[model samples]
Target: MGGTDCGAYRAGLGVYAIGRLAGAEAAELFAHLRGCPPCRAELAELRRVAELLAHCVPAREGAGRGPRTGASRTGLSGACAYGSRGPGRSR
Candidate 1:
């Protein structure tokens, strides 16, 4: 199992994250994930992005429809989502 091809295992991640992989296959992928930090991180980020995508509203039907210029949903003009960074704010 340790020598299995990474591409095949990586391909399973999307299905596995959603609990759609068959039981034995899921277990196999889990074993691979346990030993592979890069793969594990990729899977984690994929899951997070999936959650973010789920909350996204559909685009309005118009030529100019787009996310408002630079504002995140957080309403902070240029501030990062978390908060201001003192001196860094002057940069």
Candidate 2:
């Protein structure tokens, strides 16, 4: 891959990164990255972005409950209870 091609691939401009890399294709991608400074830089930036996202945590605290009970427990007793009433019908 040349510079433009590498740029296209590195920018997430294609499907390569979206899928698993394997065997000779994986080797070729790595080889291209190894010899290409711009691709290397882009990969570093992507790694940084991934690291930042990996460390991100929710702004909220706990769920503020002991442990969910009742309908929440079985997940079968909510509005979609197994054999309960239909749409507008009450419990």
Candidate 3:
């Protein structure tokens, strides 16, 4: 497939990875993915990113308690940015 053709599918990869792509567009992208190694690689990366993002938002401390301390204050700057730390390791 031509680069231009791939460009359109590439643009929608994020939406597709998140299960938001559907109907004819999704079908077309899926078909293209079967034949395009580059696009397939990109889609894999996007899916990984989407999975990581699912954990970015810290779980609520309770209904009215609000967000966790570091998450709200640092805003992905400290612990949140590094993700899970190992045992005895500091952020």
Best by TM-score: 3
Flag the better candidate by TM-score, 2 or 3.
3
lDDT per residue as tens, model 2, 13-88:
1223434556767677777876788776766766676557547954455644534556566665555653467656
Candidate 3 residue pairs that clash: none
What TM-score would candidate 3 get against the native? 0.59
Q: lDDT: which candidate is best? A: 3
Clashes of 1: 0
- Per-residue lDDT for 1-48 in model 1, tens only? 366678978888887766678988899889898888878888898788
- Residue by residue across 12-65, what tens digits does model 3's lDDT show? 899999999999999999999998989999999999999997788666557546
For model 3, the local distance difference test gives 0.81
The Cα local distance difference test for each model comes to 0.74, 0.58, 0.81
Worst 10-residue lDDT window, candidate 3: 74-83
Q: What is the C-alpha RMSD of each candidate to the true structure, in Å?
A: 10.8, 11.2, 10.1
Question: What ranking of all candidate models by TM-score puts the best one first?
Answer: 3, 1, 2
